[model samples]
Target: MSSSSVVAFTLGASFASIASAVVFFLRARRQVQKVRGSPDQVVEVQPPHPTWTAGQKQPNPFGHSRTVSFRSTDVVGGSCYPLVISAYIPRPIALVSTISKNGVVNMAPFSYSGAMSHDPPIIAFSVCRKPGGMKKDTLDNIEENGEMVIHIMSEWFVNAANLTCSNFPPEQDEMKTAGLTPIPSVSVLPPRCEESAVQMECKLHSKQDIKNAAGKVTATLILAEVVMWHIHEDVYDDNSGQGPTTVKHDNLHVISRLGGNTYGTTTYVYDLPRPDRPKTGRKV
Candidate 1:
């Protein structure tokens, strides 16, 4: 063959080989994509990099600025006063009712209350000193009688419950002032609010006095054991004998306290199932 014809033949073969390799690569890629699922449905996986390793400061994923730390003692109102009261997000409200030694009825609202145990049914609440460093009426009554009833605040009677928190005199009836009806309890001297959907009769189990740096009492922590529980039928779900009576959140419409004068409600709800761990013996 002529030299010119030979060169042209070699060039033609090279181009054909290049085109065949390109087609095979694209076809293989399509097969891999099909096995993995749709590209749009796949979530991008992020593996830990050197920035996330120990002793290495990782950039904020939330784009937040550098955080400033402060000691609780250095703060004006103490570390717990603001950090716990405000930064704690949402806290449940406890509408407590107590009776004085003279049979005077007193009712008040406290946000620093929660359940501490389930076996013996224990609950706890903290009460701060009133103005002029005097003990609160609720604490005084509880100390005298050793019995009180705690009612859960719902949306239907939240306003009335809030009114009970006012600084009323010991002689004044906060239940009457708030227009809330009080009914006789089954096992306690203090009455329960009829407006509340849930109520618990509690007897004093323990009491702790919290003192400040000056060694003066600043708050009282009361731990009580719940003797009986009263739950409204509307909020109780039997769940077809599968589990305990589930309190329907939507039906209860419970209200919670936030920072300052803010409040939260259970109107918006969502559920996310927990992911299962991989079978390779690694923690998820």
Candidate 2:
């Protein structure tokens, strides 16, 4: 072959080899992902430290590490969000349900939620504004109706619940589209998810807008007063009139939110009782 033809052939061969390598790399990566994301992995719940006592040291005590800190204001909100969520470990998820004045039902989950009081049964959740400072449908519905039902997410119905997180139009009913059954709540206008093990019917007590350093409202913190509760019989433990009521963990199958697209299950649990006050301590 001529010198020019030889050069052309060499270039074509190199391009073919490069393409083949890229295809192989992509296939291998997919296989690795499938293995890591497999749902068949057996989840055996065990005590974190079976043979531990009070004031016991960690197994790898000598492997202590130095602390690294960052100034909150120094980091931007976008970067700080992932860092805080990941470092905060597992947080409880609130699958809040609300209905607009036009009767459009909405459902979505939020990780920034928790119970604040027990006497009046107050709970709070914070909803961050979207890009361009736009309010989400959930926040708008709650502000319009002042009623919501917070449900505890469970393992069985988590897939369906996740589907409701999509940014659907306000005219769409997320509960129906996600294939979840909604039942009328006794004390609230918003419906409750039938699949949830624990549901709290609450009315908006008050709301506070959170501002950033730039004096712009970044989110809204809503405080809701639960007027009624709907607990599934399988997860409820009346204690037969003997002790305080509780929930069955195994039956409840409660799942919590982790950083990114991960979730945590309550497979392993350990109890630690509070120590009695020292007898030598001064009493008022």
Candidate 3:
């Protein structure tokens, strides 16, 4: 489309969305007024999103600049926190690291982990270092050994997952500190969680390093090949009878970090489906 057409289309969409929002607000005014308004007045408010700074590699608002990937300093400084919450506002995925009985160790939860390939079966998560600091144990164990098990934290395990974030010595296990059971896995030395409903045992594939403001290593992009998967049968779908895939909402509410001690969770959700619109441009 031409520039003028593009601008027109964008403005049209914006106005249409605003109109729809206003209609919904009017319809729900009665309900909203009950909790947040005077007996005769209605109130409407929109929650804030974590906005992006220039470092997140996001498209320039003016369409003139390049993308910028967010760094720890960006998150710490709140310049890119809106983007952190923005990225996680969708389905929140949990990152769990496990170590073996001998001496291996792992690190904390990062929401950026997910499956990339199904044929060879791969999983990925970006492990961030202290802005100018060394690699965390999660990446350390992956380099030393060749395997790890990333577990998903359902609502039940969200508290346990948060417990893993404490500042512990490299020798101390987050599992012990969190009071979770470390169950053995079939293909990896690192044990899986006895509590987690879903677990993927994987071997290292590749590492892509991210740079900090000082040109030092900021994060390591870790990709692993899924060798095995463990799931709790009871919570899974009857057809699959393997994992927690059947959980819709009540069983799988989530909590995630913001910048510091502050965090958020999806205690409630609402659906607003598309409305049917009357056709235009008729001869009549």
Candidate 4:
């Protein structure tokens, strides 16, 4: 073959290879774009702002002019009971039932009560001394017997529960005065309120006496260990194949003590999903 013809054939083959390579590259790029969706549909996401900061001052929704501040001494020492109660807006009410040494059943409601532990099941309540620094009948009964039943008050029996708080004589039965039926408790000497949806049979664990500056006992804090739980069938959620059993808040209609003469009920409910952190060490 002639030298010029050989060069021409080699150059034509090189040009064809370059054209094929370019077409293959373009097709691969198109496939990558298809897997990632349309380029124009892509939206840029921005991180959310931090809700709180250590030293940064946030915008005051109520404004500085509307804010009020007071010293702790002023509320505690002075006759500022309202301010003190307002600090703890909502508190659970415990209808404590106890039997005196003389076999008199006593029932009284105390707002200073809540669950302190769950593993061993512990509940606490505080009873303030009555006029002339006299110990309350509920406190006296628990001291003698070391056994009591704590009842959670629902909307149906809130009024009756409050009636039990009256200053009745030790001989007078407040449970009967309130028109509440008392059912025998399983593991305690004190009877449980039949009207209550939930009842806890507890044994007194410990008692702490809170004294004033003059060393006079002002209140007694009782810690009790729950031995048995009696939940009404309607309020009890026995998981049984359905998810974990939880007290239906709506059905329970639980009541809470507010400041002063005010009381509140659980009527509104909302839920928010918990955010999960990213594996890349980014906060959710």
Candidate 5:
């Protein structure tokens, strides 16, 4: 074909592909709307494999098509952030509270946080810079004082926890604005949230700056050590006899972050025990 004809054909194909994607997206959205349940509707727990053996096959083994991969270097942070968060799924939220040098209180929710070690009790969380490369109050406060109180947000106060994420001034007290009561911490200067069932008084263990390909500092990863734990009696289970006590999942009502502005609950759950390999074939 001629160069002009080839160009015309390519443009036509591109437009057709774009149109198809738009139509498919609209149809999928409509299906989601149709399948959504009411707020008061009870969610049923269904076992993924009710009575399957060790080597049993799962349903729809090849239901999905070929996977598509995106190079991180090719996309901006705005495009990659959502894709990573969505794929990670059900991230635990850290409702971190800190106090400025001037005694100003700040509370914010971070989904990029989790426990790393049990012996030393280390919890690590990442704080991304605000728009225009400005540092977040949480990072600044922790760096200044090396102290903070991390709270596990529950379903009852998730809205309040989310409210703390607003870009309020450092002088503003986010706890009062969110209607969450803050009690004094035992080991840290930052107060603990009274509404949260699990509160950990932590001190800054260390920090690492995360840089992009351009060598610009984009986020700060804060590693904290839990010095003291404040757990509500309702959620504390002492079934371990002498060892460390565990939290009652049903009573805690822990809320986790999903993609976008979505929050998930531990409403539907199942237990799967780990299997041990046969001793006869074990390596020496």
Candidate 6:
């Protein structure tokens, strides 16, 4: 029809819609009040659940004697025996890499690699103090040069990673003895391992001293920013049909720390996404 007639009809419809929206808003507000902590009714909200853990507190079965002398040095560096801590430890994807500072190179595996934050690409790990508990060369390189290259362990490279756990003087290159090839790092002084399936170079953002029950700084928890990552073509699906085809978890043959000197691997594995839980519930 006529333009004026159409305009009048549109205005009427807009007013009706506005009135309906206002009525809906008022009803929703009243309903929200009615359910606000009504004991008879419960709002079901599936909150985020932990993937790894929500901070662990494991009592060490392998801890020091109740002797209460307090100084581990007074007893033995062999350790108080079995630490209850092993039960809570996770199966880590070890990173075996060679790091350097002022020409001094250190090779080590860090089981503590974990995604602490995703936005800025932060990874965190606890660098245990050297047995007899000294700061390791890896830590020194990261602290002295403020850079580190982390390599992924695999079936082909785990043997070398095992060899790296040995305590050797700083002068000797562990990578050579471990049977690993030294490759150049993208953003650090240390060389990444060409033999490793994957690698990431990181820059130090912050590190804090970790003290024992005796208040001695025996370890350091390091938080670093991943500046670059080098994933081997064989490990990921590039869809170009040019990379290594299959990688069995068994083939990777990872080594893990068990109680005492015992090491373990993936004899069996199962995967399931973590279940969601209520964040605010008391769980009574």
Query: TM-scores of all models?
Result: 0.71, 0.75, 0.62, 0.72, 0.76, 0.59
Off by over 4 Å in 6: 1-81, 96-98, 131-133, 238-255, 267-284
Rank by TM-score (best first): 5, 2, 4, 1, 3, 6
Global lDDT scores for all candidate models:
0.78, 0.81, 0.63, 0.78, 0.82, 0.64
Compare candidates 1 and 2 on TM-score and give the better one: 2
Q: Which pairs clash in the backbone of model 2?
A: none
Model 3's number of clashes is: 9
Winner on TM-score between 2 and 3 is 2
lDDT of 6 at 11: 75
User: Following a full C-alpha superposition, what root-mean-square deviation does model 4 have from the true structure?
Assistant: 20.7
lDDT of 6 by residue, 184-229 (tens): 8867777888887667788888999977667788778888788987
Model 4 residue 201 distance off true place after TM-score fit, in angstroms: 0.4
The CA lDDT at 26 in model 6 is 62
**Cα RMSD (angstroms) for every candidate in the order listed:** 15.8, 15.0, 11.2, 20.7, 9.7, 20.5
Q: Encode model 2's per-residue lDDT on 156-238: one tens digit a residue.
A: 89999989989899999999999999999988898999999999999999999998878888899999999998999988997
Q: Model 3 segments beyond 4 Å from truth?
A: 1-17, 24-88, 100-107, 238-250, 254-284
Model 5 agreement with the true structure over 183-247: per-residue lDDT tens digits: 99988899999999999999999999998877788899999999999989989987657545778
Q: lDDT tens digits, residues 98-210, model 4?
A: 99988889999888889998878899999999978999999999988899999988888888999998889999989988999999998999999999998999999999998
User: Which of the two candidates, 4 or 6, achieves a greater TM-score against the reference?
Assistant: 4
Model 4 residue 273 CA deviation in Å: 5.5
> On residues 1-284, what C-alpha lDDT tens digit does candidate 3 reach at each position?
89999999977766654555555556455445444433222233342112423353332223233235434442432235455656564434546675644575554687666678777878888877854477777777777887888877765666777778776768888886787788888987888888787778888888889775567776788888888877676544543554333434334334555544455554433443223533321111
**Order of models, best lDDT first:** 5, 2, 1, 4, 6, 3
lDDT score of residue 178 within candidate 3: 81
Candidate whose lDDT is highest: 5
